[model samples]
Target: MNFEHSDKVKELIAKLEAFMDAHIYPVERDYYDFVHDHSNLWKEWPKMEALKDKAKAEGLWNLFLPHEYGEFSPGLTNLEYAPLAEIMGRVPWSSQVFNCSAPDTGNMEVLARYGTPEQQKRWLRPLLNGEIRSAYVMTEPQVASSDATNLELTILPDGDDYVLNGRKWWISNARHPRCDLFLVMGKTLPNNPRHSQHSTIIVPRDTPGVKIVRSQTIFGSLNSPGGESELRFENVRVPKANMILGEGRGFEIAQGRLGPGRIHHCMRSIGQAQRALEVMSRRADNRVAFGKKLSDQSSIRQDVARSFCEIEMARLLTLKAADQMDRYGNKVAKDLIAAIKVVAPQMAQTVADRGIQIHGGMGVSDDTPIAYFLTLNRYLRLADGPDEVHMSQLGKQKIREYNAMKARPAESRP
Candidate 1:
């Protein structure tokens, strides 16, 4: 019920904001320009390493990993990491500067929590040190990937290796220059129970038969440097030791990974919505339309007010989910996680739409981040799970809870 951040978190937030102000904001345009440039596709920005080093030197690295992985984690709880993530979310690319970007964050958490010692040493260590990047290769081209049980990739056993054959698309981070690993999910026990049929394995990006078929664009943008890619795993062979957790744990690992990941996405969307609102408000204040300032108009004021309310609501819900996850566990906090995942992205998309309307032509251009915010939030609506999916599950869960409560004796009911 406590709304205030603890002193430690407040300090971390201040430090993170100071770092962002000093380094990230100044080069935001330059970063965007490089990533959008066709010549720099899949190439790491020259200054990215230097920025990351600065973030590391300032002790702002790996703030996303909740578990204490010795020297890798800062030991912050999910609740503590939420605000810092929100700050980083303001500038989408800023998360990488602090080594707190997605796919890598979720991948590292999986390795830290479930990887074998050898697996940790080989992949987790370099990932933690930000020496390389990774991709979570799960979604497939020919299946209803939202329900992961529909994934059709095959990982049959060989003498001492697993041969993977599948097609995966929308694989984020696959195009990064230093993307050295892929946490690939495929069916290893197809005859097993539906939930237990799949397994996740670590495949080296340079391994034979790991082909980059094409880069997938989001609304015509390549999202360079770490663009989403379509990959073909044609007899891709990886050692048995590369299996994560075990043969039947892919679904379990994925569920665990996404709970935290969903919260992170929601908070980042809040940041994007917040920045869009600010940009819109500032534009309204400065622009004159129909003989008066846009800010003086009722519709503009209402748009700002509604956006503020929605952003605050989404942020509070995300923090609540984070707190519940920190105190209990992801399994217990599933409802709230689903709630935020369903709510935040749509909220951000709505706010960004309003911002775009207010800014007129400039809103859709690269001059402002509102256009990017719109794209990201819209994508988020379908990224983790579509709003409809979360809504359906959440609705069912709520009904079941109420039914169980009604089934209990009157004296036992709250």
Candidate 2:
């Protein structure tokens, strides 16, 4: 398939890259310093707010939304948006400036796709305007979360309302001061078949009995504004109108939500790997050891070459997945999505490791972004579904196909 970027995509990429160079990259230090100086780490950093306002005014806002929302976005196709996502990936936190951050992007998609008019007006509108942020609450503390149907949270029917009770951790963006809503999943009918029992409902953050138990940490970083959090819902109540789609359709919604989310992560990860390779190559070229440039060392050269090859492979696979989604729908592209989900994180992690090795002690420290990059990429192995889980599913599917072929008559078989 032809994967060339269209003229429109190229223009958007140029705009995004220029925006990053002019604003984001230069302020990385200042942004960190501002957060460190602020006593309430959860509060929005001033520099981020300023940049967000600038980005919104410049019409670079909400580039992630594909479906038409009147005048809200350009509604670019999935393939068209992939390269732009790569540019945003160069700076991990910069996607939010253009209102394209995760969890929020996925949540917005849910509302846009399934929410009623009332739901859209109440939540989706503000989200499109960048007035607030939201989170997804699905994983639980007591289960093997890889199998989402194993989730044991309950959404009980009460007179004219539903009461939610569960414990969820790794609820990203929940700790952000501006995060005021959640798209929560729980079993609405425990007696139903496993996949058909769960449902998703929108719950406001301030509803009674909803508690933010504490912020969870990733590799000891607690000061992050989008800090992962553990939430407890003890009889938290919301109107029945909060249900999206209908009861017993949570799995369907999740499938649609995660298809886009997974590819978006891959696109950004290509950029992360690209940045790491840049750092590694520059270091190898200029750093001298034992009277020779590191670039002259055989091991260093091999790593650089390998990193380049791996990044290209991952990027092409990701683009192919995007194209399949555009042409055949997400269900038709499930295998491709799982493949890239496995490939991209490993590629980024490998590139980050090589960058760290080239930088020596400086890489492991906060002096460079390598350590953070490594941490983020490594966690992605378990993000949507773990590598092992995807591999298992893919393996089973292949085995089924092989068995079916073997069972066929000789003329019908290959």
Candidate 3:
């Protein structure tokens, strides 16, 4: 199979890499400093705003949306977008500068695919323009959310409006000052079949009874501009027009939304792992331990070598999933997506762990980004679907294949 990226994609990659070096990488410290110095920690960083404006002006905005958006689209196939995603991912916060951050990207896809015309005019337009941010409220504290159908949130019809009552955690981007919307998933018909009972609705953040209970920290550090949040919806109300693609379609929308979202995470994790490897290699070559540089030691060399191999494998698998999504559609690529979701985070964690080990004590410190990278990658292992969940799904698919083959005619099977 042809694996080479198109010329257009290559050109964009060069531009994006240069943008990261010239703008993002240089301001990483300033961005953090701005956040730390500001009292409104949940507010957007001014430096980030400047950088985003510059990136948008340079035509680097919204690179994640596929061709379906028409004039504003990235026009790149999933394979073509892989390298660009990797570049954007090298720095954890850099994705938002180009308006390609998650939760928002996934939410935008839902709006583009399922939102009514009125819904698009109000939410999708601003989202595409990056005028405001949004959040996906799906996971609940009381449920094993990996099985999404187990969600217990309720959206009951109240005359011409729907009243929402639920508690959701890990609601990313909801804490941002500019976050004006929420795509909430809950059950509208609890007694119906598990999957068919749920629906996703658009709930404006300012709606009465919608409260941001608290911001959740990741390993004690609060991610700025938006971190995970705990939210409470006590009779939160929205108009009937707010339901996306009608009632009982939450699972369908979620499947479509997560297909691209999960793969994007995998693509970005490769970049994170690659960056970690780069740092590890540099540290190993320069740092002396027991009378020799770490690079000269057998253990360090083996780790670097194995990390390189693993990162490459994960990248290839991620690209394959993306390509499959592009060619065969997201549903058809489910197995590949599940495989990469399981593989990429573990690959990233291994690379990050090696980097930490190579850096000795400094790896665990904020003195280097390795610690943050490690934490971020670790969260990914559980974020989309835990490794165990994906593994089980993959195993089930394999068993189904084997059973189908066994039932086939003898000649055909042979």
Candidate 4:
């Protein structure tokens, strides 16, 4: 229960914050200007590689990978990585600068955990080096993707290759200029048990029959560079070696991957909310309304207090989830993972909304990150799984858990 960070984690946090203040915070607006320009669609910011090189040289690279990968990982646990993630989360695009962005982080974990040595040599090496990016193609336009068993994409065996055919949407990183591959999930064994029917296979983005239909927008912005996209796989094929953990193992890899990823997202959401709260407080203190500062108003004071309390609550919950995952395992910590997944995003969204109100007109504009924070947190509710889905599963688990306790002798329960 002790959430005190180890000496190593504290040192890393100090270094990370110093890096962000010196580099990321200074250029935040310039980075946004480059990405938001219509002419810069799908183009990397000119300075991204240099920033990444600096981060790597400073030993800040691959901070998201918790498991030991020899020299690839810094040998930190999930609990240790939480504060670092919160630091990166303050800037949405800054994670990639340190090779800690999502889709890639989750993909790297899969390769490290499940990919063959050859697969690791080809894909994982480049990803860890930050030479390329990747996409996790799972959701679909035709089915309710939240229920992954309802996935309609097909991956059928054909001699030495697996042929894939279907449509996928809301895929992050598909439009990245350096995106090299996709870890696609689809039905590979239809007649198997419900949970065992799906398989994950690596598909090179340049593979034949792979087509990007169009980039999807978040609130009218392209979310440029790493655009969410809809992709079509018409007889796309890859070698059998690309199959990860063999048939009927997609769900297994997914379960393992998502536990850490969910906590990471929550950690980042806390950062975003924290930033919003600070921005709101500053605006309230400085802005005058009706001949008085907004900070002097009782309503504004209440909002500031509530946001501060909620951010702390979410941050602690995320740390507890990270601690549970590190000490126990993803399965043992599933309930807490689900709880934080539902709570953190909603908390961030609420805090951001309040910040937006406090900022008045400036909040809705790109002048600050508050608007994007609201959007990101809102979509996160549907990303890993919907709020209702987690609540339902958690409810069932709690009911079963309490019922088992009830069936035990009263003395034994105590």
Candidate 5:
């Protein structure tokens, strides 16, 4: 509940800022150009690897992880690491330099919390070392994935292995050449309790029956780094050893991993919103119309004011959620997570839209990152779970609390 970050987090923030200024910002254009120009979206750009090595050598690697996984993580708590994630969020790809990017961050948490020693040695170690990448194959093309229980992929047991048969879409990281493993969630026992029917199993990307139907685009753009993809699993055989945690426990593992993952995105969105507001403020001050600076214009000033309020509100909410997750458990903080999952992305998207408006024509064009920011932050509203899903869940939780309070013994009321 403390408002200020700990001293260690401040130090990391300083170093992270310096690293971004020197390495990331200087080549932001080149980085995007190199990756976007490739005919194949999956190919690697060597500069990314070099920058990653430099970041690792500087001791910024694996900073997103908590103390429980000291073998590979930096051992910082979620509250301590949120600020660092925000700094990296200023530039979309910057987090990857420190190996703190998503899907990877979430996948790492799952492995640390649920993987067996042998599984960890084979997959988690390489991921920690940045030797490979991964994808979470859960959402299906045929079903309404928002429910998650609607996942229809079959994980049928065969001799010594599990055979996967289904199709998944909007899967991040699936198109990357380095993404060698898939942490797939599917129904192993349809007859079990709805929440307990699904299980997570690790399937190698090159498994015999796997097929990538195509790479998907987000808002008419398929930027590299982590491209959206569609994949088909036709009797893909994976060793039973690849099952994570246990059968009928995929939702449990997912819920555990999602707490940190969702908050991390919120932290980064705050940072992005902060940067967009900064850009907007300067633009208002520097640009002039009708013989007066935009800053002097009431409407422009109001935009700045509104943006500042939203950024502060979103940041505090995220911090509160992280604090709750650390003190209690993710289950206790689920509603807060859902709240931020809805708020943060919308905050960033609004800030991005205002920033774009301030920039006028250049905003929507590739001349600035504003357009991309607007698009991606908007997409985030639908990412982990869409706004409707989270809002509905939060609404239900509030009602439950209200009803419980009303039903309590009269003497218990204040």
Candidate 6:
């Protein structure tokens, strides 16, 4: 019931907010300019490197990891990390500056929790140090990737190594110049139990036959420099020791990796929504339409009000999920996580839509970040689990709980 952030978190939040305002937003223009000026889609942005180094030197680094990870993380719990993530979310690319971006964050967590000692020494340490980036290759274009058990990638054992053959798409950050690893999920033993047949293995990006087919664009925007990647692994060979946790543990590792990732995504969406609302309000109050400010119009006022309510509701639900994850574990908090996962993205989209409407033509163009924010929010609904999937799962779980309660003796119910 206590929703207040701890003092430590509050202090850090202030620092983060100040950093974003003074350091991040000021140069966002230059950053995008740099992105546009680069003809090579995957080339590293030197300006981003400077900002990252500044953030690191200021000790604002790796705040997403739940605990001290090697020598890089700051040991912030899920609850403590949620608001900070929201701050980073305001600027989509800001998280990476602090070494707190996705895929890498999830990949690092997997290494910290389940990787063998040598695995941690080799991959996790450099990842923690921000020396390299990684991609999570789980979803496939050929299958209903929503059903992760349907992962069609093949990982066949061969004496001392495993040969991988599959196509993975929508992999974020795979095109980064520093992307040195891929956490690939595939079927190692198809005859095992549905959930147990899949395994996650570490495949070096440079491994032979690991091909970068293309970088998929969202809404005609190339979103280059490691936005969305499609890669093919044709007989890519990796050592037997590369399997994480063990064979048939993809589901288990995914369970651990995704909870944090979901919360992080939700928190960022909340931040994105907040930014949209801020921009929308400013635009409405300042702009005159039909001889009156947009703020004076009844419809704009109502939409703004609704956006605020939805943003607050989504944020509270996200915090509830984070709190539950901290108190119990991912398994126990899964219901809440699913609920937030379903709510946060839609909330962001709604708010962003209103912002776009408020901004008129400029919103749809690259003149403002609203267009990009809306795209990200829309993608999120389908990213982790589509709206339909989360709704179905949440609905089924609710029905099961209701059925269990109905079967219980009336007096036994709380």
lDDT of 6 by residue, 300-369 (tens): 9999999999999999998889888888988999999999999999889989988998999898887878
Provide the lDDT at 223 for model 6: 67
Q: Model 2 residue 235 lDDT? A: 95
Candidate 3, poorest ten consecutive residues by summed lDDT: 405-414
| lDDT of residue 346 for candidate 1 | 94
Winner on lDDT between 3 and 4 is 4
Report the CA-based lDDT of candidate 1 relative to the real structure.
0.92
True-vs-predicted CA distance for residue 145, candidate 3, Å: 1.4
Q: RMSD to native for every prediction?
A: 2.5, 2.4, 2.3, 2.4, 2.4, 2.6
- For candidate 3, report its TM-score: 0.96
Tell me the deviation in Å of residue 342 in model 1. Answer: 0.7
Q: Pull out the clashing pairs in model 5.
A: none
lDDT of 4: 0.92
Query: Which window of 10 residues has the lowest lDDT sum in candidate 2?
Result: 65-74
- Candidate 3 per-residue lDDT, tens place, 143-210, comes to 99999999988999999999999899999988888899999999999888999999999999999999
Clash-forming residue pairs, model 1: none
Model 2 pairs in collision: none
**lDDT tens digits by residue: candidate 1, 29-127:** 999888878888789989999999999999999989985566667899998999999999999988998888998999999999889989999999999
In model 3, what lDDT does residue 182 have? 96
Worst 10 residues of 4 by lDDT: 405-414
TM-score of each: 0.97, 0.95, 0.96, 0.97, 0.96, 0.96
